[model samples]
Target: MTLDPLAALAGLGFGLSLIVAIGAQNAFVLRQGLLRRHVLAVVVVCAASDAVLILLGIAGAGVVFAAIPWLTTAVRIAGAAFLLGYAVLAARRAVRPRALEAGDPQASPGLAATVLACLALTWLNPHVYLDTVVLLGSVANTHGDSRWLFGAGAAVGSVLWFTALGYGARLLQPVFARPAAWRILDAVIAVVMAGIAVSLLLGL
Candidate 1:
């Protein structure tokens, strides 16, 4: 299992491409980042989850996943339900938008609750398995003995993305301070969550 720079670089690019989408997980991270509450915990949970999934894929768990289609179906249904619930919450927030108040203790959830939400967003999403475990695994294994190196690179990409999304979101604080801005953001989140949930259900 020799370390290969080319394989690692390819894995990095592939990993970034897959995760750079506007998904439920990204949305949650961005929101937490903007709120500046439990950002580090959320980032850690998301990045660590991605790393584990990528490594699992490289370790040939993708084969097991593929062999058991029913498992993914069950996950998909559960994810869709979770997404729908989040969508409703987002829609409710959109209906009653509030400006960002950094000093407001009630504005953000507690750390434990935040961590739980982050875990749910990361793990309950069935697409995560397809992207990280199945697809990334297939691609990394093609690197032969350098597959572990590729997995490492992909894991790094995940960490980088979540860190950026979670910490860098503070940069948008000025804009999001406006209640209208939050209204728009929540509206968008509602749509994205509902759309993804519907797609998941349809696929199942």
Candidate 2:
């Protein structure tokens, strides 16, 4: 289908607004980057998953997502709990420093596992559904004949953002390899996750 510039721009703007936020998914990506884990796999998985969701949104399937009130609430609760647990784990990691020796890349996470993890992180979050599929799609649908253009723009935005997040964080790997830096980063992640959990609980 032919793409419309105005619709594409609108979708691009919407995608940026929602995806640029620092949240659980971003934290996960940053963690993977810090550990120097399956970087390419993680980026591909996240970007591809976002493309699919944006397409689904453009296809008018957003209503289905909106209809699942209970499911969304359940996901939100689960996400909050997971974040809190992760925060505790991060706090522990911060307190106990691990050896800085790099492990064999081959022994780390595989492509399939990385993809699955990213998919679960993206799909299991109620916020993703509401922001990308429901709210963003609703706005794009108002474009009438240019709806698919909006989806394409959103898909592109996802690719750009995920690549930047997954790869860009790697720039700090050299610094983070130091035991002290690792502790600080871990502590920051813990605080961010805990704050997010509280925010979710307060419905903020």
Q: What's each prediction's TM-score?
A: 0.95, 0.83
Question: lDDT tens string, model 1, 1-204?
Answer: 466788888888999999999999999999889888999899889989999999899999989978999999999999999999999988887775343354456556899998988898888898999999999999999999999889888989999999999999999999987878877888898999999999999997
Q: Best candidate, lDDT-wise? A: 1
RMSD versus native structure for model 1: 1.4
In angstroms, the error of model 2 at 1 is 9.2
- The residue ranges of model 1 lying beyond 4 angstroms of the native Cα positions read 98-103
lDDT against the true structure, per candidate, is: 0.88, 0.75
lDDT of 2 at 8: 82
Which candidate leads in TM-score? 1
